[model samples]
Target chain A: MATGSFATSGADLELVGIQKRFPGFTAIEHLDLVIPAGSFFALLGPSGCGKTTTLRLVAGLEDPTRGSILIGGEDVTHRKPFQRPVNTVFQSYALFPHMTVLENVAFGLRRRKMAKPLELAQEALELVELEHLASRKPTQLSGGQQQRVALARAVVNRPALLLLDEPLGALDLKLRRQMQLELKSIQEEVGLTFLHVTHDQEEAMTMADTVAVMNKGRIEQLGAPEDLYELPHTAFVANFLGQSNLFTGPVLEATSHAIAVEVAGTRVLVPKARARKHSGEVTVGIRPEKLRLLTEAPPTTAGVNTLGPGTVTDVSFSGVSTQYQVDVPGADSVTVFAQNLDFGPVVTPGTEVWVSWKVDHGFGLEDSASEEAKFAPELDTATIAVQAKRDLAAELEVS
Target chain B: MAFAAFATGTAKEQAPRRKSRIALLLLLPGILYMMLFFLVPLVSLVMTSLQAPVEFGDIGEYETAFRWENYVVAISTYGEHILRSFGYALMATIFALLFSYPLAYFIGVKARPWPLLQKLMLVMVIAPFFISFLLRTLAWKSLLSDEGFLVSSLKALSLMAPDAHFTGTGAAVVFGLTYNFIPFMTLPLYANLERLDTRLVEAGGDLYARPATTFFKVTVPLSMPGIVSGVLLTFIPAAGDYINASPQFLGGPSTAMIGNVIESNFLVTNNYPAAASLSIILMAVILVMVVVYIKRSGTEDLL
Candidate 1:
């Protein structure tokens, strides 16, 4: 709904027609974003996807080759970094190595001419719960401690906006998860617009209100984390945000409410709203967790569920969930994640099963063949087998 | 499994032994070099420094004896020169650091984007090293001569006292030392500043630090290791330099340094004991100064 109206008046950060080009590569191009006041926003993308570049443009560390950066409705494109009412938590934490923790936090406040800089710095450290280590230098602190200091350093300034450039990337997984919650609580308490840049989809989904998935110098999709996870517009977003099983083929039928896409021998019914383009030769997608596995074939009832017979190629029990790889002959291998309710027959490799999911759960996708090519190779061998199976199934089903 | 564990244990034990063997192999040439050039000469110098002149013998004649008075005599006779040499060296170190820091900063940090300019500036810093240090000091002598173009022009512009000369002055000697050791100061500084994490500076700016504040608080403090090393590199050599302060170069008899005094005792006067004692004193003094400087450099805990 934030995209519904062009409300520039209260937008904490606005980047219009932002483009950054280095000597040989365009880091960002035609990027336009408006982050509303007090909203937590994240730019989620892989490396070289211009998410970091956009963050830098907003941070005033880089000049946009072609556009205006307006912060709090003020045109700050020509302003220096220090002149802007914004700050950043760098990926490396970039704490002043020479200064003590208290001194580091006090740095920005002192520059801003606070009346009681040390008192305010102590308050900031207490916010991150690191007041006890105030006298220690940055190198003396642990990775997690340094991260808290970095967060304290930026949040202490109380800028109109704060940019976190993968601030938790240096921590271990457990510490990262803990910091994620801590950062969210801090962001909520401060009520400042947080512009976080991260490649972690889970982190973005867990903390950010809005996530803009970037790829190859462009915003592929931008929406609420739930909306993006549920209704991804591009193949890149669907695959990058989480695991996705894509079925690209000709459209068999199209209606206002729904589009039936024929993939291999099975026809997938996706709501028209989910489809980026409801036309001929489109790609249909579904999430791994959305797919259901059944030992017996369900009734071939229309609108009930779409079904495909396949052999269980892999079964992994991950305590809470059991992930299955089902290979349909002449079709791609499909991934199905089922909760471990401990209520069904144990599915193992080489077992016969039917892959089924409701029609409404399937989503539509646009041209993702290129995006698929770039990130698809990083998928494990089972996923590749699924793709290979799809190719064979396409030829077999059509004939 | 038990046998494999035993093999792993033996492999672990052998690994350090192999490493030590390689270390010994690597250290053999260095040990040999130090023994032949440094340790042997050091022992001979100690013997010579302790030797006394033969009673009622010729001025140059001396014999090995426990005459610790050679050190006392050396200190009393050349104490002024010793202090003057260190003072001039300290001045040159400070001047070289001031000159090289900005040059290194501009080239290594600012001109990094322009590859051609970086190469050109680096070449300019190192080009002097390709020429002999003595020849360069001699060139400076000619340049600062009373009738030379630089001095004559300065005289015409009234920048210098009309009758004041630079060729034999202490200022000229210190200036010569600074110029000769500038690359020593610049290269180490450039090496450290070049790898500077620019993000810290940007972080400072993002934290609302003004440009000047960022430079002093973040950039300069982070470059301290470079400054300390550069000062050490320049000071150590400048203190021991002889030719730059010799009368044939830029110095006068009144402006003689410890190096010039030691050179005269060894080659001109054949006073071996005096030369040896003065050399040892200069080494001891420079070592103390270097250690004290390092302690106060604020980079003690850092690598």
Candidate 2:
């Protein structure tokens, strides 16, 4: 994609230690972010994670409890949204219902006391490809048409920054996918800094050059999409960004480049470059795709790395891939995805399987004693009860 | 199989017939009521407007004669009163609009938890209806009198020099009309503005428009339908009201409206022909103005 070269107007937006608290609840805590003159940034999170609050703070819609917001290296923390050179496209588009498409697009221009508001509005409408619908009212147009009208209405003023708060949330899936590409292209062509907010990981991965994953009102991690996916630092990031299987065990041997951990009286080796801390017990993390399943049990256990023998409890056949649940001894059940190859019969329930993975593919983290303190005393009794319940439910469902 | 298919087709065909019969049955009472009450009275009023006056003493005068010139004589003779009626109505509408807009905007947009305020406003609007219109106008007269509480308060505040009076003037008539018609303007405006999308204003603010500009460009245009309705509501009734223009209230010959003139012609002067002609002319004028207003504003379908 050919994007217009954005001039270095000197790092247009900066947020320094912004904090927002509502009554007893804190929505954003000590948040620091900086965007260059032109950068496509995404704030990704689950619900109630304060991505929207950060955007609102940047746009000057909400005043921060602490810290300052600077635009073009000038403090604008107390300035109103209208005083700032930023515009927002809300999730609902929020086009004026009473006005024609042309009037809606011309609203900001007219408010600014421009001499030729109609001409400017026409040019904007042309930019969004809504010129033919200029005379039609908002309700007379389709959803996508209304969206374009909203876009034109904002971009007509040529603001310094554009904030899009889940603008494609209301569209159908196909329309959403189409608009994602369109929005990126438009942002590129116009050379405007876009700060987008979304909960969809795929949307952030596809559009944002840099992604910030937020959890519990704080940014857990911020990096490029592939970097965050390949090397997640925190347990929340590893779990939230994508799926990963975690194993808890004690480190029996440690070295500069590798560590051997003992799980259920069996030794497992993990690469040390990915390990965070390595003295005592540590948690090992591996992605589901890294594990391999074999039909026959291995003859010898030497040099096999980590091996688990269990029966296939359940199998799910997706169109292009298949997922199998294997119940291992003294370890949590693991989910493994396998390609649906035509060379063999499909794996089904009640089939014996061996799950094994290499040592270099796994990473370790320090074990927090808090988790053990919370669950250790009652684990022995609860595990048997949970297993019995699962068995009964499965039998009842089959019957 | 063939018999079953034929039976299904027959059943589908008969379903619509049965539904049509039920629909006709449901419509019968309304049609009958319209014929008996509305259509019959309108036809009779038009017919009576064309007939000669019923004379009490002369048999020759009792003979029926179609006299359309009575309309012209009635209008010309009471032209000032007709014009005063329209003038008062226009003034009342303008005043109501000016007073009602801020009140409606405050109640609709600024007041959170709006259902309680809406109920309170509904109570206040209906409170006037509970009291008789004649009594209310008389109350206004007393309140505006020279020795009344309002005048005394103004005198105490040094705003009035003890010689000022508000009663028996066009100002009093306009005040009374406004007091009665204000709710008619506010309720519709409140209803329309309340239903307006708040997101539109937020969007405007986000697009670098100040609050004042947003109110003018977005809020006002969106609520024009309610404004037009409120204007018509205040203007039409104010034009046809005679109680507000009665002499004992605040009106004289100069302030007498068309309704007063029509009432006098019918009751005091016993000129039925003139009264009927005046009624026809007033109705025609109101109809034409309403049609033109609807056409010009492009809000005919709002009603």
The lDDT per prediction is 0.85, 0.77
Clashes (N, CA, C under 3 Å) per candidate: 6, 0
Fnat of each candidate: 0.93, 0.80
What's the DockQ of model 2? 0.39
Model 1 misses residue B65 by how many Å?
7.2
lDDT of 2 by residue, A182-239 (tens): 7787677767788889877778989998899887688878999988887666665666
Best by DockQ: 1
Interface RMSD of 2: 5.3
- TM-scores of the candidates, chain A only: 0.89, 0.82
Model 1 lDDT tens row, B1-303 = 111123334455566543567778999999999999999999999999999989999988999998899999999999999999999999999999999999999988999889899999999999998999888888888888998999899999999999999989999999999999999889888888998889899999998888899999999998887888788888988999998889999999889999999999999899999999999999999888877876787655432
Q: Ten consecutive residues with minimal summed lDDT in candidate 1 chain A?
A: A1-10
Q: Pairing residues by index, what is the TM-score of model 2?
A: 0.84
lDDT tens digits, residue span B1-303, model 2: 111123334455566644577788999999999999988977766665666856585432323578787777887898888888888888988999999999888778777467798778667766888888889889888887878898899999999887766776677788889988998898888877788788888887876678888888778888888887888888889988888887888665557888988888778877767777788788888878878986787665543
Error of 1 at A172 (Å): 3.7
Regions more than 4 Å wrong, model 1: A1-11, A113-119, A129-132, A265-267, A300-302, A328-331, A344-353, A368-371, A374-399, B1-57, B61-79, B111-120, B155-162, B265-280, B300-303
- Best model number under lDDT: 1
